[model samples]
Target: MYSLTLEQDNRATVSAAIHSDRLVVACLCAAWCGTCGSYRTSFETLASKHPDMVFLWVDIEDHADIVGDLDVDNFPTLLIQRHDTVAFFGTMLPDPAVADRMIQSIAELPDAELQRQAQSTAERRTWQSECNLRQLLNAPG
Candidate 1:
């Protein structure tokens, strides 16, 4: 499975992927962050394990237009979404195992429950607005 590293040249591919029905797993990082660089391999490995999902590596500084409004307080922040629902969005540890487990647990949840949680709290609702990859990609500049 190929993991997409979002860049100016690949914006079209990333945008296309975001419009799909599959779950999107995005790693929000910065190009200059050492931790983010070190964690890239692990993130790709995790993506390899999940062939059905769409994995994206987004450099916050490089693609500021897409993720500038997102409050990514730490390196390697994660955003997981499916369709219009932002299932999870927060700072994640650098450990790939933790990410794997979190993905598994979230993917296991019923769609109805996930949709409910997407709107159950204000923070989660904010994800719908700020962390939705499709919305960000399609947003007007």
Candidate 2:
């Protein structure tokens, strides 16, 4: 598993995985949120199931420099991506089953399809521009 719990000590390694071609499933949360705390275990189990992909646990407060502009209005937001396409980005229910289903559904779509959807609607368009994780990771810190 190219999986990582993002932290200051391993920024470069996690950044490299984010830049890779593999599907990136990032759970954007805050350490202080009770819901986030409860959801942590499920997120890890999900990561273990998808060893082929890169699963990242991002504490928004800890990695604000990268995910701050994400405008997270809720706890346990999910950023699902494939290459340059931001397939899905939004607050998901804290249900691991739902998150797992999402990973499968999104990862099944082709990049061209994902890109098309990103531009298909106003909300999705915003995601393409604002929620692109790779772009966020590449931003100057």
Candidate 3:
């Protein structure tokens, strides 16, 4: 397990941490955020269990530009990456049970399988958005 103490000076470290054989779980947080402060301990505990994966805690204020590609509008956001590509992105608080479930799922998956699933998920999201847009356009004014 990797515990990354992120700061403005360590932006490059964060980028390097994600490119691993094991999945990467990057928690984008802020020091002043109450939710982030409270969840930090639990997040660390969860990280210990997933020894194969890389776990990082990135403060948004310090490294906002590095994580700017991620639309982290909320604190305590999680970015899951496998093979340097994002597998999941969300702003859910720390929960060891949920963490265990996700780590277990990712650990069991092979690179090819995970890539296929990610592609499938992206395609579904694109299709859903397109369908909604088409429906809105076709609706009577």
Candidates in order, TM-scores: namely 0.96, 0.94, 0.76
Q: In candidate 2, what residue range of length 10 has the lowest lDDT sum?
A: 1-10
Between candidates 2 and 3, which one is better according to lDDT? 2
Per-residue lDDT tens digits for candidate 1, residues 1-141, read 757989788888988987887788999998899999999999999999998899999989988998999999998899999887899889999999999999998888889999998999999988888788898988887
Candidate with the larger TM-score of 1 and 2: 1
Task: List the candidate 2 regions with Cα displacement exceeding 4 Å.
Answer: none
Query: Per-residue alpha-carbon lDDT of model 3 for 17-112, expressed as tens digits?
Result: 655466777687888999899888888988898787788887777754454444567877876666644556676746667866876787688878
Poorest stretch of ten by lDDT in candidate 1:
1-10
Candidate-wise lDDT, in order? 0.90, 0.88, 0.66
Off by over 4 Å in 1: none
Residue 20 in model 2: lDDT: 84
Better of 1 and 2 by lDDT: 1
Clashing pairs in 2: none
Most TM-score-accurate candidate = 1
lDDT of 3: 0.66
Model 2 lDDT tens row, 1-141: 667888889888887998888899999999999999999999989988998899999999988898887889897999998887788888999999999998998888887888888789998888888898878877888
lDDT of 1 at 66: 85
